[model samples]
Target: MGIKSFQGPRQKQTVEEIPLRVSDYMTKKLITFYSDQTIEEVISALIKHRISGGPVVNDKYELIGMISEGDCVKHISESRYHNSPMQDMRVKDRMIANVETIDGNMNIFDAANKFLSAKRRRFPIVENGRLVGQISQMDILKATIKLKSQNW
Candidate 1:
């Protein structure tokens, strides 16, 4: 029974497939830090990775906090005028607790917005309440830049 309206046939919705989500964009090889580590160690890790920051996890690989180069440098700046030795200072003394973390399965948009909003450059990707990987701002930029090449 054709009840003909004036409009022609509709086209099928073309969904631009975004294959790679945050997990695909994140750095699966994570180098995590412990809360007990000193600021010296944290700076070393940051330098080695060439990353601005990284996730601080417990022994069980739970995301606890984040350590950034800025955080370490802040102490350095403050201590420069004083006799306070930054070497003995631990990450627990400078690292920001209650940091925001994202799950590996989250979308790239979510991660990017977080980066724009926060004063951090790194984020830890957790799964099932356990640390699975780390996501840097670079990862998001790389993935989003090459969305077509994403294997998803």
Candidate 2:
């Protein structure tokens, strides 16, 4: 007599496409700053919004640089040392002019890797040289939580 197999017919596995792009988890509504704005104004906004940093843009809303609370603090220290008035300082003077940006279509995993490699807490998502949104470490963590429940 021939041996019988115990396995039954296998069913097709349907896996859901995970939403893992930078755009999928980025914050679209951003509180941006203008380069001409005074550092005091930036500091006020930062305090009001409870944010550490923000992107600096021109009149066209194109990203030009980034300003952070640390930048403002540095300005304060320098101004005190130089005997200069803090009211005269502008965001453009203390902002990080050389800014790095990421693509919106990039995978979130890759973005996390980027954040790790670059030692950045957030990355600006740009498309066609225009600021679209921003992705932060918290966003990546949120994505991770969502993916974890989906058998990631």
Candidate 3:
């Protein structure tokens, strides 16, 4: 007798295609700070918005740097030591001038790798030399969840 074939014809699996582009997940509406703004203002904004940091831009809305809670904390510590006032500190003085940006069209997986290698919380997306949006670790997690059914 011929060997019994237990398994039937394989059925194709269907997966809904999801766009994994960075732009799709990046935050378009952002609370940005001005270089001339006072640290006190930035601190208040951070607290009110429940955000750790934000991007700094110029009059033309060009991304110049980033100001974070760490920067504000450092300034506060230094001000206490120097007996200086916090109001005197400006965003430009404490912001990170060398900002790293990503392209909007980049794949989400590639962006995740970048976050791991850069040790960054978020990456700003720039287009035509203008600040467009920002993608964070949270965004990557969201994407992973959405793509779980697929290759993941």
- Winner by TM-score: 2
lDDT by residue (1-152, candidate 2, tens digit) is 99998888899999789898899999999999998899999999999999989999888888999999999999999999999999998888899988999999999899999999999877898888889999889999999998897754
Better of 1 and 3 by lDDT: 3
Provide the clash count, candidate 1. 0
Q: Model 3, 50-133: lDDT tens per residue?
A: 998989988877899999999999999999999998899899899999999999999999999999999999898888778999
Please list all clashing residue pairs in model 3, or write none if there are none.
none
TM match of model 1 to true structure: 0.78
| Candidate 3 Cα RMSD (Å) | 3.2
Inter-residue clash pairs, candidate 2: none
The estimated TM-scores of all candidates read 0.78, 0.89, 0.88
Q: Which residue runs does candidate 1 get wrong by more than 4 Å?
A: 1-18, 148-152
